[model samples]
Target: MNRSADIMILDLSESSAYKTNLKHIDFCGSPVINKDHWLYWGSRVLSTSEASTSNVLMRVAEQTEFLDDETFETIAGCSKSENYSQRCSRTSLQSRDKLMYIQKEQLGLESEFPQHLLPDGKFNVDGFILACDVSKETVLHSNHVINIAKSIAKTKKPIVIAFTKCDEMSEECKRHYMTLFLATKELKHVLCNLPPVETSAVKNVNVEYLFGSLAMLCLRSQKLVKKPPLAYHEASLFVEQRNLHVKCCFSTLLSQAVPLCVYPKKFLSWKQVLADIDRHPDLMNFVEVFGSRVAFEMYERYVSEAKELWAMNRLRSHVPRLFEVFQVFLGVVDLADMEWNMARDYMRCHPLFSVLFENNDYDLGMWSPSTFNVDEKSRLPAEILLLPEAGNVFEQFRVGRSDGVVAIVNGK
Candidate 1:
């Protein structure tokens, strides 16, 4: 919403959602390339007659569209063919535009804009200003904008909804806005419980605040980028300042310091790691050789024997067995694309670790030379370790790390 913002308005001429916004809504005259669907849209600014309000232009596209007779016949022939998929593929290869239209129904075309046109690292917009007219005609379109905004940014950009033509809204229209905001509160990019700024250039009401919010958002985003990372003590102090329980934050930090046993460099596989641990009943060597490599990597940095033993003990207590540690490491590698600070916290608080530690009646205590238990040794292999179940449980853990970080920071 900045005064100097470089805005790009796309004229989605073929879109059903945008059809009403056009001066002359004529879809029946346009030719259809395919029976599946046909939408002819281009990038253009809204005409003065089309734009009823001064708010910035935004668009929401729908997959559904109409097709002409010849195109419909071609598609129908392709469908009826014995090699339907093959024919479809050939058609796509022949005409890229046709393929694009066909793919729109199954996979959203907007996804291509983010993935291809705006590849990661190339473009970084400060924020997105979603301008919508608050009326029955745009009710569904507004929701679509919210959804598409989230899809485009994916938590990268802060979204500020500017409800245009607010001065023209009725009491019923006002109620609708409230209902819509409440319904979309769970969406990621949209600020939770925060109502859209009721704006009107015609009335000159809340227009300044709408733009000011954009500037403030840009400043906040910049501050986050320039801010230095907090040290351990500083982070603890930060948690305390936020009214989080100091003791819990300290405990969580301490959990990270507690050294786990060092794991081997090259793993033979999960089966091999388990088999080796079974063959060599020595807990110290078992842990030192087959524990978490991530833990082992941390262990190498610590000079004190007490800290090392504490770490080793923690590894034994929380992630004792070879297979469990292996699985945890797999989860670690799987989410390597995530930020380190976020990923580590997830590794600490994720419930999968709790299940790994708490489920089995076995607790491999601190490593010692003279300890040998035949009964526990016999029971180890027979005790079922559901690897697939653990994977399924933590499947969402990486994606939900933001929530996990909030919980940890709040001492929850």
Candidate 2:
């Protein structure tokens, strides 16, 4: 058989397998041979050639079922009068019912269509990827993650656990990783136990390795039918390069920033600074103002100093109440004047300003008191403040108060 001339487009609607056949028409070869019937659409088929173009169109249309009124109207409008698109549409409707009947009798999809077409006109490939986050204090979170993983496992894809922040672990704490590893192994053993599980972390991590593995699986599946792979190494390489560039930019910033005055050794690093912005992609627009160089430097300084201050002073103890006020200040949380009063009442009960201003004696009057100043609305948090006087050391004494006085009352 000549393969080129043998290419056939089969319309299975008229066949006995019409009910059970879910495969695409292109899967059938030229002069398609089936147990129920044969359809020859190859160039060599004189009968197919002799058939009217309208009849050919109608036969082609018969294979697809239209369920909705709009689709029925669309098929009707696309139909040729001589070929009667309506008749083709009717045949499709009937073929669908017959297919359902066959499924009920054999495959057991008794009352419903298990597979539906995507809006983009493709079949849904039953597959899923499990994204697990395993971190300290997040072990119980694994239960929730596993539930989702199990539901998606039914789709027949590999499940992976993303263990975050493992760099903070000590040699003694290494057993925690072992425990997590065993837990994942046991979970898989009890569950599907189908594909080998993979683990990753954003730090000390091959972030794209797991995704690349999944992509390879999808690619191999596609190759069975001579289709292109869903993902290629080039895409992974692009992500890797993008992340490297971002890290380089962040590192350059940290080096230029001055060490934190209070905690010199605890200065912010490029990784921590970038992690903050990475966690919240929305803040990216503000990064442009610092110019790539200045922005990185200032962000490093700000985050480092902030974290140092918070850690040393135990300021986070005040964060819950402070966050309530800060959220309102940041426009995330809203409250009426009375609510503001309530928040102020709460703040007064806490040593918030005292804790924050402990070592820092910058003039509050010189600085903008309100978190939201109308003039500097567009500026970032660090940019809105004035730098302290360079090398200006003040005496550790408070100035005495003096009052203008008239002569003593009795003397006057």
The runs of at least 3 residues in candidate 1 whose Cα sits more than 4 Å from the true structure, single-residue gaps closed, are 1-124, 136-146, 153-155, 185-189, 192-194, 221-412
Q: Each prediction's TM-score against the native?
A: 0.26, 0.23
> Residue-wise lDDT of candidate 2 within 307-334, one digit each (tens)?
5453433322222232223323323222
Candidate 2 has its poorest 10 consecutive residues by lDDT at 390-399
Instruction: For each of the candidates, give the backbone clash count.
Output: 2, 2
The parts of candidate 2 lying over 4 Å away from their true place are 1-127, 138-147, 167-204, 221-412
Clashing pairs in 1: 258-311, 259-311
lDDT over C-alpha atoms for residue 317 of model 2: 28
Tens digits of per-residue lDDT, candidate 1, 1-412, equal: 3122222111111123322211111222112222223232221222222132233322211222233333432222223342221221111111123322223222333334322211111112344555556543333545344445444345354556666665565556556655665566444335441346666655445654555445445444323222222322343354345323433343233233332333221213334433444434332332432344532432334324434454344333322243334345443455636544444455446655454434354333422212322233222221223333334334444445434421111122
Q: Give the TM-score of candidate 2.
A: 0.23
